[model samples]
Target: MFKIFKLKENGSDVKTEIIAGLSTFMTMAYILAVNPLILSACGMDFTKVFAATAIASAISCFVMGFYANLPFALSASMGVNAMFAYTICNSMGYSWQWALTATLMEGIIFILLTVTNLREAIVNSIPPNLKKAIGAGVGLFVAYIGLKNGNVIVADDSTITAINSHWFTGTPLLTILGVVITAILMVRNVRGAILIGILIITLLGIPMGETKYAGGSFLPASPYFCEFSFSEIFTNHKTLSDFIIITVTLLYVDMFNTVGTLIACAGKSNMIQKDGSIPRTREALMADAVGTTVGAVFGTSTITTFVESSTGVAEGGRTGLTTIVVGILFLLSLFIEPIFGSIPSAATAAALILVGGMMIEPMKDIDYSDYTELIPAFLTILMMICTSSISDGILFGILSYVLLKAFTGRIKQLQLMTWVVAGLFVIRIIIGILS
Candidate 1:
């Protein structure tokens, strides 16, 4: 293991990698419960979905470790799964099987792009500010998601969101307390501060009627063994146009998160090539594509490299060994679902909010003095948080950048790839409206 993972070469050993892995897992382990809770609305079995989540996450991390040789980890994605469970499965009237089918198809498309050089072209074309803005945007988006989950914010009749003044009630109070304690831990430079916050809040909530508890078997059937039948690919007799749109939506959204996570996490790890490209670009991206396909087969929503993996990188994980350790932890999650599931959303929300806080350092790299870079970058951050869609934010940013450059007589300076992406974004939007 030492020779294979290059413990000396990467300046990381078994102990350090293990600590980093556990830290990363603790930060993202909320997905063990949150994913099932969200997907259960689609009639998925909670125990089965939990197992699938753990398996998919493990597979993705292993692929990243052995294939990409990066400290990145993967799991069922937050934004895409919300769209998958709520928008596609529930609101759009598609069965969960059909949704997985669309996700599987998207994965295949991502793989094709990786093999064909298109993925590299697209990744190379994105400007630096826009990429940093994508990271900052996801930070805001994650924070927004945490607040929404905690009921710290709620829908308003007039304004889209407003502060929940009734937060002193049941769970929201615990959420506020969690965030405060988590912040204090971070301020004191506590090691594994996020995980410490999660545990402290969880323990604090047990006596307050906040965390739920139920007695059952300590172990559940692994979805790897029991849940295969539910997520097989299936297609309805719906209009071809609707099917096409959903497939495209899934593909675009997955790609957005994958690329954004790659760039942000790589930047944090100082793993970027001198030419401003990520090392092992194809293998890393292919791991994400493979993760999505395998996740669908395992009976779960779309899987992708998670932005929360930055938490591991921040903990001084330098090479694939960190990811390998994470893979082991995810597999262990299968046997401990009951304990993880008992923790309330508020506790997990605190961790996500703190992770977001660490992610904003990228925004400092943006060229805020230049309007050409600033406008598009600002739009990317704004639309991502407001619309809760990373792909939409990137699309608007690219299109606006292209148009502004063209009208400002700087079109000649733009790369051909930018125009191609703008065209694709335009076509997707037209199809969205027409269908």
Candidate 2:
């Protein structure tokens, strides 16, 4: 297996890779509970969704490690899952089955785009500043996820984002301690610092009642496969536009979120080529695409590359071996669900917020002298943080780039597909308004 993975060639070894994998898993293990919490709102079974989350995550990680030779781990994304349950199902009045159907379609589209290299073309088409901005913006987007998940930041009735300090007594207080401990560990260059922090915070939380001991079953029940709702989806002619919007929205977010994360992770690994493509690019994307297709079939939302894999990279995860370890850990979580399920959100939030802070590392490469470049890039970062939407940030950033270039008589600088993408985003927005 060492020879097969070329661990040394990738500048990694068994011990380091194992540590990296464990680090990555600890950081992202929150999805086990979080995915179920959000998806069960759609009336799905909590235990089943929880089981599906781990299974889907494990499958994707194995595919990525064996096939793509990258260190990134895959899981049900928090933002997209919220959109799946809330926007598509509850608000649009579609069944969860219909939502799953849309996710399947999105996965197929992903495979098509990746195989055709249109995804690569989109990545290369973005200006360097915006690309760096995407990385930085993704960092903020994820940190926003951590804050919201940990209840560090609460929705403000009168303002945009207000600190919920009044309710920061128990879990929230522990969350603060976790972040501080994790940050201190990272600063001190402690090995497995993030994972160690999670373990420590979890132990502390058990006494405070922030982390609960939930009962569990030996195994998830049989016939666990969740199928698409194609028949119902196609029959609803009135919701054709809704279906289109939902599919496209999922596709766009998944695509760019994957792209932004790839940039951040690859940038950290020093894996991006001079021309701005990742090595084993097709395989990595294909693995991600397959994970989504398979995950939707198992009754969850979109599964994409987790940016938290960067935490492992920061811990010296330079090869697919790290990913394989993460994959195995995820599978193990299926049977010993009680142990992992006991960890508090505050623990995972610590790792997430710390990893998110590390995501800004790529921002150093952005060219600050050029206002033309700086303006859109800043907007991308701002919109991403403010809207808490990765795709929305990229969307407005592209629009700004196209409009600015056109107004400045620099249309020649823009790529043809850049213009095309900008126009499509505009059209999508317009249709969204009319519908």
Candidate 3:
């Protein structure tokens, strides 16, 4: 394991990797509960989808660990799952089988793009400032998720969003205390601080009545294996168009989701080189590509590299050993649902918020005086928080950068692939509006 992952070479050891893996898993375990709920609403069996989520996540993380040798985890993406259930299956009147078919096509396209190095070129073409912006934007996006999940922020009728009125009470208060505890631990240079905080808050929640003991069958049901609807998808012209659009949307979303997350977490881990490229770019992309294709076959949404992996990186995970640990835990989760299920979201929310705080350090590297650079970077960060979509954040950033550069006679500074990316975003917007 040491020779394969080069723990010493990556400045990480087995113990640190284990703790980091635990931290990553703690923050993302909510997906086990959430993904099943979302997919089941669209006619999937809850228990089967739950099992599929766990298995697919384990498979993806294992690939990422052994193949990419990165500390990242992979799972059915939250937003892509929503689109699969809410848009493709629910609103569009397509069956869940057809949605899986679209996900499969998206994964295949990702593999082709990765093989051709188009994905790598697109990633490398971004300017350094925008790269930093992606990291910073991810920070805010993550923090926002933490806040919502913990009920630190609540939806309001008068205002679009507001602080929870019961903030001093149950879950929200526990989340706040967890943040303070974790922050103090961080200041003291404590190892496994985030993981420790999650555990501490979970214990505290037991008395607060926020954590409930769940007693039921732990066994997972069988998935709808290989149950695709290819004939239904290709039956007629209108169905074919819908299939194409659904597949394209999934492809576009997962592409940027993977790219933005890789860039953000890579920046956080100091894996981005002086030339602003990540090592093992092909292998990392392939992990995501293969993960998605396999996930669709297992009856789930598109799988992508998770941003929550940043929590593990923050805990000093630098090697694939950490990813291997997460993969193992995910496999274990299938048989111990109640154990993982009992941990409240409030316990993990604090860790995410703090990691968000840590990720913003890259923003200082941006050249503030260059409006040409500053505006796009600023938009990238702001839109991510406001829109709550990584792809949208990157789309606005790239479009603004290309437009500003072109209008200011600095178009020559942009790469050919940058222009190509900008054009693709434009096409995506057109398709979105038409659909």
Candidate 4:
């Protein structure tokens, strides 16, 4: 039975593969909780978001395993969710349903791009330095979110503040402790360290009254389920501009995120060809686009491939089995929210911090040899930290790259598509600023 799904590669053990898949699934289990939380913040129905995530994960995982043949997983996207909540919902005042509709449109656009092989042209046209900058910038932005959400950093009137308190006094302190413990375990090369950290923190929360078992109930009662109004999406023109901006931003972010993740995971899984390219990338992209569209229709934000799945690939997963296991786990979550919800935000915060720390390793890929590269990379990292948006960081990085290259007479070396994308970024920024 295992042979049906297992890779035929020499020296690959089935037992190790299973373990790797489970590890990856555990590392990403936070998504089961985080996805709904983010959508809820956007005033989406929690139940619908949950359903969308499960469906997206199932489709994305199956496609990744069978079609892409790579050890990666896809699900409702994190960065895109943040953009939906912070930019579209908060800044633009779009109803959650309308935001979802925009995401669906973006997903369709992504599918078209993938089908035509434009994804390759677009990715290759990006300067290698800029790509590296985007990766590191996204990592930093996600880490900032982890910190902020964990309440490690709180915003004052004009500055960020850290609450220095004892571990037992509050959840933030507990999160800090959990982060330190998880980091220690990860550095020690312990298997399932992330899951272990979550367990430990959940246990701590239980004792501290931060978590409670929903006695005799299989699923914790969620008050935020399936409450979105699709009619509101079409009727509300007040948020059209916001919807357009978010849709475009998420589309670009999902595109690059999937590209970067596929490349990274392909390298790690040894799925790359001798030329350092992953075959069937278009199929994988199509799967992602489909997943996003499905998610939007089901009432959520964009769905895309997760780079965090690499945490499991690094452990030894090499086939679709890993994603299959993840999908099964996600399906099981519907009946077990109490177990997950019992896990305090502090615990997940720790996991995010640990994951963030691991993600920062990609920074080494940035070419520091050229001043032009270094400046853009630095700007990308800084913008991500300051603006707290991965897309914003990318925009700044690309803009910086184009301006620097143009001034140095190297503009002709860039592709036409590069200039076009850079131009779009400029226009978007101008419109956003003007609005």
Candidate 5:
């Protein structure tokens, strides 16, 4: 069984592989806590979210390790959670059940696209430059989310406002402190710098009473398990629309995020084919879709692959054992909220800031020779920061690319998918403006 799962490669020791896998999972331990909190805030049952996240993480890790044969781990994606909170919940006022339905539908769509090879083609059709821009834009979007959630930035009447506090005498001081500390550790090439930063902030918050520990005993109870419900999604129209938008958003974000992560990890692991394609891309996508669908039905938001898991891969995880270890740890999570809760947002923020920095490297790959690439890239990055949605950044980027190409007599350069995306972007923007 171990051999079938590639738990032990020809020369690699099983113990060593397990160690590597555990280390990788450690980098993402924050998800166990944060994902549930995000979903709970969005009106999901806390117990259900907890169970769903664990199941999703386990399934995602299993698929990534054994089926997809990558070192990546899957969970409720931070980007997707933000979309569920800000767009689906806040903007659209969709219920949590409706949003979960959307996520399941998105997973189904993703699976179909992957099987038909349409997903690959859409990925290919994106100009390399635009892809790089998408990377940078996603980085900014992730950072923006970290800041917003951490209360570093707040909305104001005329414009967005910065707070003044002890860190700044209420001036986003804690946030600044968190960012600077994380950035310094990252610059020093510290492993787990982000986690460390979060720890520091969390500990500090404890003293200031900014955070409280929920003093509950940890144990895997019946509370954390749920079954999939296809009927809840298929029978409702509002649920259907919610599922469509949220699922499309999840699929799109994961598509690009996974592509970027794969390219980078494959380069480091020598997993890329001679032709420069990452082999098993389809399997990986399928695994991601299945994990997410499973996650939603189990009562979580949306499960997608995590780029941060690459930190563990970079540390020497060479086989599926690493991800399997992650899965085991998640199962153990059923009994350990206190340990996970000890982790602070500051530490997670630090890690996010560091990961955000690492993600920006893809921008260097963009072909700046074409103005078409340059313009769309700029717009994508800017929109991500200002509008605070990774999907918006991507949609705007695609729309900008198509509009520019069409107006400049380069209509042939636009893909059919681009037109379809452009139409959706127009509708979304129109609704956003009207709202």
Candidate 6:
């Protein structure tokens, strides 16, 4: 086990890895609930989607552990699931099976790209400063999600967003207390501080009515396995055109989302080499591709490396052992649905907020004096928080980087593939405007 994980070389041990895995699972287990609820709106069975989510997540995480040997976890992505339900199925008026077909195609394309190393090339093309910015941007993005989840922030019509007025009571208050508890534990050098905080807040919420136990059958219904709609997509010109657009959009979003997340979590784990590259990147990316394909087969959205994996890396996770432990917990969650389902979002929000704080330490590596680098880097971090999309954050960064370089007579500093990527982003943006 030690030899397979290279635990010593990675500066981690089994105990640490286990704790890290628990922390990560606690942070992301909300996906089990959230994914089903979102997808059910598009006329799929909730319990079936829930089962598929756990199964696909477990498979992906295991592959990541054994094949990629990285401390990362994969699950149905929140953004892509929203697109799958709200855009592809609802707005586009396609069946859920048709959306699954698009997701399958995207995953297959991802596998092909990984096999040819084009995905790796895209990662390599990102400049050092932009990479640092992406890491920090992900930090801000995660922290924002934590705040929103804990009700520390609430949506407002006039101001756009505001602090919850009733934050002193209910879930928000418990969330703040949990943050304090976790912060004190960290300061005192407690192992599994994040995990402990989650459990503590969950217990406290019981008395405050913040945690509700809605018991249900533990057995999951069978998923919509092997259901697809290929002929409907190819029959007519309009349907074919829509299919191409939907597939391309899914491909674009999943590609960059996976890239950004892998970069962020890899940076957190200190796994990126000095040359702005990550080892086993192709294998790790292939794990994501495989996850997406398997998810579609099982009737779910695109499964990719989750940014929440940062929670584990922040807890000293360095090797695949951490990932395997997380996979185990996901499987266990299937039988103990009520217990896992009862874990309130506020209970895990503090851990995410704290991990985000840890992840931003890499920002110091950015070159602050160079406007060409500084502005784009700043925009990357700012837009991630504002737009709540990592891919969009990277899109603006790459576009701005290219524009600034070209206009400032520094085009020679930009790589060829960077230009190509920037051009693609521009085309995607144009397509969005037109459609």
For model 3, residues 1-435, the per-residue Cα lDDT tens digits are: 789999989998999999999999999999988999999989998888888888889998998999989999999899889988998889989999999999888889999999999999989988999999999999889998999988999999998689999999998999999999999999999999999999999999999998887665777566668879999987899999989988888889999988999999999999999998999888899999998998889899999999999999999999888889998998998888989999988999999999999999899999999999999999999998888999999999999999999999998999899999999999999999988
Ordering by lDDT: 3, 6, 2, 1, 4, 5
Candidate 2 vs candidate 3, TM-score winner:
3
C-alpha displacement of 283 in model 1, angstroms? 1.7
Q: Please provide, for model 5 over 1-435, each residue's C-alpha lDDT reduced to its tens digit, 9 standing for 90 to 100.
A: 456656455235566566556645655777777877877777666666776688778877888778866667778887678777767777777666667667777777878878997655554556656666766666655555556555666776777756423335222455567778877876896754554566677677666665467656676544333344456566678665555555655666767556555544554455645444556778877888788778876777677767556555544566666777788788887788677666555445544555566656667766778888888988877887776555666777888899889999999977787687677568666655543
Candidate 5 ranges beyond 4 A from true positions:
1-31, 38-44, 78-102, 161-165, 168-212, 223-278, 307-325, 411-435
**Candidate 2 wrongly placed segments (more than 4 Å):** 166-168
- By lDDT, the better pick of 5 and 6 is 6
User: Number of backbone collisions per candidate, in order?
Assistant: 0, 0, 0, 2, 21, 0
Every model's TM-score: 0.89, 0.93, 0.99, 0.81, 0.76, 0.98
Candidate number that wins on TM-score, 2 or 4 = 2
Best-to-worst order by TM-score is: 3, 6, 2, 1, 4, 5
Lowest-sum lDDT 10-residue window in model 1: 225-234
| Model 4 Cα lDDT, one tens digit per residue, 1-435 | 256564665235666566666656655666766888887887766666776677668777777777765667888787778878877777667677567778878988988888898886665666766655665565555566667656777766655555444434667777887888878887898876776777788787777776576433465333223334456655656455555666676777787667666655665455655544466777778888888776766667788887667666656677777776776766776677566556567776676666655556657867788877889888877886786655577677778888888899887867798888788787777766866
lDDT against the true structure, each candidate: 0.79, 0.84, 0.92, 0.69, 0.67, 0.91
Q: Give, for candidate 6, the lowest lDDT window spanning 10 residues.
A: 214-223
Residue-by-residue lDDT tens digits, candidate 6, 290-341: 9999999999999999989999998899989899998998888888889888
Query: Alpha carbon lDDT of residue 238, candidate 6?
Result: 86
Lowest lDDT 10-mer window, candidate 3? 215-224
Residues 20-112, candidate 1, lDDT per residue (tens digit)? 777678767888878988998987777788888899889989999998888888999886788878988789777777777777777888889
Candidate 5 lDDT at 85 equals: 72
What TM-score does candidate 1 reach? 0.89
Evaluation by lDDT, superior candidate among 1 and 2: 2
